[model samples]
Target chain A: AQSVTQLDSHVSVSEGTPVLLRCNYSSSYSPSLFWYVQHPNKGLQLLLKYTSAATLVKGINGFEAEFKKSETSFHLTKPSAHMSDAAEYFCVVMLTGTASKLTFGTGTRLQVTL
Target chain B: EAGVAQSPRYKIIEKRQSVAFWCNPISGHATLYWYQQILGQGPKLLIQFQNNGVVDDSQLPKDRFSAERLKGVDSTLKIQPAKLEDSAVYLCASSLSPEADTQYFGPGTRLTVL
Candidate 1:
């Protein structure tokens, strides 16, 4: 079985400061990874996805993530944070095979403060 | 295009009562998925459908939970004799196809079992 672990349960960053959310994965085979964000009362929105194409994946809202196969990590990062960036983020791993089930990590709540 | 659509943004039902949720996927999407997300935990796949056929339902609790996608466009999930543990957010997502990597999500229906 494949799974993802979000190291931080909550992250706080000041406006204009950098933000980082850590995630690690455990999968028997090469896996596809994704980052999704959910604002208050909103649906989950895809931030980016890594499908063995590019190691550095750029996503919407100036967010990005790097897929490091060596460390089995795909951490989300932003050069600068904004007040609107506050939301819950999820790290997901797509299970290999037919069904292509997605295994999500315990979300990390991000708080952007002024 | 319009994203996935789910009805009843929030629902409250007594224990042992039955509840149902509906979802309408994006136009032209050939695959749909249902997930259960407990508070403070990640979303887990409960079922998957390709068009109007069932693809993977191994994780779904068949005794209490049942889902169907008729005409391959609209879907419904029902839980009979709901339990406290079943109180969670039910999310619906759809992709262009089973091979498509991007799966757009709908605003989840939050279920609270009293």
Candidate 2:
């Protein structure tokens, strides 16, 4: 079984400031981690994933995440935030090999301000 | 590549009514998924299919919800006697395979149960 926890339900970041969203997971075996962003009335878009190949993963729209095995964490970050970045972000986890099922965290609503 | 496609962007129904949502996965994508996302919450897996075979439906409300992937290319999710609590956005996603741990999603159908 696998599960994910998003540390925050809401995160506010100023435009041009750094953005960070924390996530943790519990899995018996190695797990695949992902970050997805959803704007209002939009579909969920894949941001990045960590699947044992690389500890640091970069994605589109200036987003990135690093996997920490020791801490069981996959936190998303952005060097600078833009207004377009304001959206709901989700942390999802899949089983090690099969990736048959995905467990989603109770997403964090990101608010970017000027 | 074209992303997943879904029909009826929005629907309104009253309690004890029925509703259905359709999905067409990306071409040649063998794996498809259905998720329910309530406002302010994350998307929850409802069902999954791999080439016309059901992979999982543990979280689906079997008493009132039924889904099918008739041809292994397109799928449908139906909810009967929908309750007020059933109001949510139904999202469809597809992937090449579970091993990839990457999924592309559709715009999703919003259902409001009055």
Tens-place lDDT per residue, model 1, B36-110, is 999998888999999999999999999999999989999999999899999999999999888777889999999
Residue-wise C-alpha lDDT for candidate 2, range A7-105, written one tens digit per residue: 999999999999999999999988889999999989999898888888999999989999999999999999999999999999999884564787899
What DockQ results for candidate 2? 0.75
lDDT of 2: 0.92
**What is the Å distance of residue A29 in model 1 from its true position?**
1.4
Error of 2 at B14 (Å): 0.8
Q: What would the per-residue lDDT of candidate 2 be over residues B10-69, giving only the tens digit for each residue?
A: 999999999999999999999999999998888899998888998888999999999999
Candidate 1: misplaced stretches above 4 Å? none
> Tell me, what's the RMSD of every candidate?
0.9, 1.2
Write down the worst ten-residue block by lDDT for model 1 chain B: B95-104
The candidate maximizing lDDT is 1
